[model samples]
Target: MKQSQPRYIMVGGFLGAGKTTAILKLAEHLKRQGRAVGLITNDQGTGLVDTAMARASDFPVEEISGGCFCCRFNSLVDATRKLTATTRPDVLIAEPVGSCTDLMATVTLPMKQLYGENYRIAPLSVLVDPIRAMRVLGLGGGRQFAPKVTYIYRKQLEEANLLVVNKCELLDATQTAKLVAALKQNFPKADVFAVSARTGDGLAAWFDRILTGELSATDIMDVDYITYGVGEAMLGWLNATARLSGSPVDGNELLLRIGCALRDRLAKADAEIAHLKMTLTATGDGLDIAVANLVRTDAVPELSFRLAEPFTEGELTVNLRAQAEPALLERIVREVAGECGAALGSLASFKPGQPNPTHRVDAGGVEHRPVLP
Candidate 1:
């Protein structure tokens, strides 16, 4: 029998938690299972790397920018309606902004109460980078986010129905075991799973759980709006679009150079990188693209996707998130893009403002209307 409603799954986590890779993997899995999938990508600005990556895969995608899903509830609904009208996908996977939390009360709850008949809201799964999780949880030592930033990270974990530890390949048996144990102990209600989105290891079990899982009734997590707003403002966001020209240049190599340049410059400024990713697509051939990601200040950028042949010209999209000033990020990107032979076309940089959700509902089934400006 055909289902009456589509499954709506939101995969969320902190910046560089491998949400895009995991979502793509899951979409591929669903396609093989004869399910049409639609993806929704969210960001603070346009020129999003995630949006480019998703579109490259040939999936129907809708992008929601300017704010997160919670704050832009109406936009979220509009994206779904548009997708439904066009593709009518059997499953819709939405990736929320990494720094925004309080989804249980602000997003899922509202959708479940308002549009329950139109869609089946699955359990919220929040992914986490083991290295970052360890540092934040005091399990290991490394560069860490400020206290306010850590507060947002903790709140995300608190609200997740499924706590997923992605990129497990980076951890050893003992380390992975300890981290899983710690998460289970910390969030007793959430079921924990560790898998690598890059390597197909330990994914089937997780995929099965999420596909068959249902959201349960639980107390909403308490979030301090003041701290959430302050934490977001501390992380500078920059999105730039550039035209890559000059002789036939290797897109992959150019991406690495720009990523390294930004990493070095930001490190000198004492800026902790949350996530820096870029995509280079052939000027006319959208399918031919190169992508790179750098999740930490100390880590080297890795090419998640590579171009087949060198291209003389292409379109470059760069998304950078770090604990630095927006001006510094813009200057660094502008310099690096020029140095890498990419003529900067458009760029936007700013710290995200406070979040004011359009609709918020608590566990008691009461709605909290947002304060209009």
Candidate 2:
């Protein structure tokens, strides 16, 4: 990697792990250092809530939809190129698909081998939501995925060079210290950092590390693609775009109705929600957008973000990931969206489909060529 190359950093985690918010925090830090910044977002399909939310924040973002980074390696490269060519950002922050793992083998190593002349890739930083982390570590009782689905989550942490315990605001000093100790004990190779992406409590140290740290070359975690496929197939995903019209109060009410309805349905089925994210962007006001996120069944729906003021009509993007069938997920979202749309006097809809990763390259650093038949 040459000094002329721009620094590349990827922040990954399981669903609802606050990757986007952390990316925004990192981008702000880089900008303060007088470094130009660009962001890349990934998803299993188009009309992504993450992409829209990032754009709403006024960052230079390019989205790789239809698959995760591992499954869409070439598309990931293309998005990087587009950002570099247009924004010429001094630092590039990428947020991989939450459910995707094996970054050391699939993403960073390939970029270092092929594009090292133009990009200095940083260490893999995997973020974790504190509540989910506690449940996984057995410190608390909450909804969690089955063993097969959980295989992907643990592999994410296993391969991480830096395991970030995000959303520090959820726990106190003791709980935070305990979780950090557990992570270090569980994964000795990785450095653990606790930061609140919502409040910027510990972002300073985490941001400084990204700006100066070196990416480890050796790969970790032996991923089983067959099991990976099964685990991913168990998750049902839905991304929908809808036209919403109502007062600021009505808009918020409408959004709440859709969210609550889905929550009740998903919880009733005993299906743990991987993540359900929504964003409402008004025309002509990119900076003012409403965002909401729900990661678990026990959690209440709250506005992770709020606009200066809501608009009468705006574009709404809803993203859903859960342990239910695609048809059931689709039905729940559509029915709720339809009810809200009718009451609020607007159009609401979405398209849900089975997610299939188009490409799964397993070669670590040695293989320069993409795994293609």
Candidate 3:
């Protein structure tokens, strides 16, 4: 039966898990099924690459800044209402902050209990970058985050109803099987899928599961608020905007240069990159844009979207998340942007504070206020 109420689906994961790409893919799938879709993107600050990416696709999208969906519950509701009022979308897909966890307790349960009449909440789906997951699980060789940061990553998986091992193309059959087995062993309650959002491998099954699946009741994991805050503080977050003017420049090359330079600097500083992405859009033509992403320090920058024509003047937005000091990240970005012919404009850099959720549900479905920092 076609549902009357709009469905609320939230896709979450740690940084660099390809959450944005997955959400967009899911939205596209939903649209093709004759269902209207809306997207809500969350971030810690303004100038989000995710928001820009979604908007460029001409989807009715809204962004909640300055916090994750758990902390900005009211804003999440507001964005949904705004989209509902305008687009009347049948399915609303939300991508929460990548570094955030505890979505079942903080987001899904609350929405189901409080706004049950308005939206049908789907099971929480958490995506993981296979390589990162292997390293975090001590099953692969790669740079890893500190214990504190890893805490956030593990907690995300702990609360998921659907565990999606994204970027399966990056691994072989043997490696993929090993990672899937590990995830199954650790999170026995959740169903796992190995998928590649870029190549469209193993996505149809996952999409079908989410589209028809309902949120099932489960035990909520105990989260240490103080440690969660400390873990978030360990990551430096930078979001910047700039204006470009001069001869026609290759936006793709510009983004690659900036991403690679930043990656090298951070690597030399002994900092591990979570995810760094930027978008260059012609100021005169919003639709004409180039987008690039660097998920790991060792990985090369990939241009996900490219502009058809080179522009002499455009607007550039850079979003960098890494395990370094915000001040240091900001300084490096400024230097790189200047060299790349972009005049930096408004910029904000800081570490995420403690997790203070607007509404938190306990194991028994009771609501309580989380202790704030």
Candidate 4:
């Protein structure tokens, strides 16, 4: 028996934009209303902190690893097929690679033109951290990404059907107004919204739109592939899974220690941090997550979540993105694992190469092969 085509709600943004947190909020909202939800997480590598975080929330997750959706379109569809075979969720919430843009041409178009019979593509939403918005919009001063990297980030905003200013709590009414005005002035076409996914400040309206609003064709932003590749190469990407055992250490504390150590290492390298997030899930009843982010070179690392207790054994997933050399990032990861008493497992650390879209078809019948860098 064939079930009805489910809805695909994609949430996109640049690094440190809080896309995962917003997706979790939307999932929880949908679940509360008796709607079955399935999640899809994409990354350049495996052992994704986002994947682990979704599973920690107890949602069924399908991870499209090794590449972004544009490069792994077939795998994304296959994951959806597998989820349909099992969970058959009414809504499929997906988070694409933060560094990716042009989804209207790549991901959603393929989903609609080919799988129109199986999936309803929702409006394209792009999230932005308030602090990031200020820096990107030139409304405030802070250490920022290089010119090429900022180009990719700007393209992400330029292509948004809905531009969501996440982490609104950090901004007061006046500051929020200023940022909103700046975003509107820049991307006048996109409908701007402000919300705090953590505090539930203004998510209902966004959720309602995603649930019932219509989705139409979007403008494909002009992107220079060479520049995009350069921007991506400027950032070192690291993903790893480690085993933690012996004398139960506070999962939160251990993660904090590891993150602090890594932050110090990156700082010494004179690297500008983008985002460093980790999640630890013990074999017992729950999971703990610790995320430290340094948006710029001269910024302090801020922990988003801290563990409450200790755990004996579990799996830990760590993901780091920064403007630095991949070799240095890889070395710091190894040293951090050793110094923090973690038994390392499968690990991947490298700079993201140019995203070569394997499929750019509007209608169905296109087979996409994963392009590994």
What TM-score does candidate 4 reach? 0.91
Considering every candidate listed, which one attains the maximal lDDT? 1
Q: Which ranges of candidate 1 are over 4 A from the true structure? A: 368-373
lDDT of 4 by residue, 89-199 (tens): 999999999988767678887788778788888888999988877988898887788999899899889988899999999989999999999999999989999999889
Window of ten residues with lowest summed lDDT in model 1: 364-373
Tell me each candidate's TM-score. Answer: 0.97, 0.91, 0.97, 0.91
Q: Write the per-residue lDDT of candidate 1 for residues 100-131, one digit (tens) a residue.
A: 99888888988888888999989999999999
Candidate ranking under lDDT, highest first, comes to: 1, 3, 4, 2
Candidate 2, which ten residues in sequence have the lowest lDDT sum?
343-352
Worst 10 residues of 3 by lDDT: 363-372
Whose lDDT is higher: candidate 1's or candidate 4's? Answer: 1
Candidate 2 lDDT over 115-207, as tens digits, reads: 878898888899999999888888878788988778889888988888999999989999999999999998888999999998899888888
In the range 122-223, model 3's lDDT, one tens digit per residue, is 989999999899999989898888899999999999999999999999999999999999999998989999999999999999998888899877778888
Measured with C-alpha atoms, the lDDT of residue 23 in candidate 4 is 95
Q: What lDDT does the true structure give each of the candidates?
A: 0.90, 0.79, 0.89, 0.82
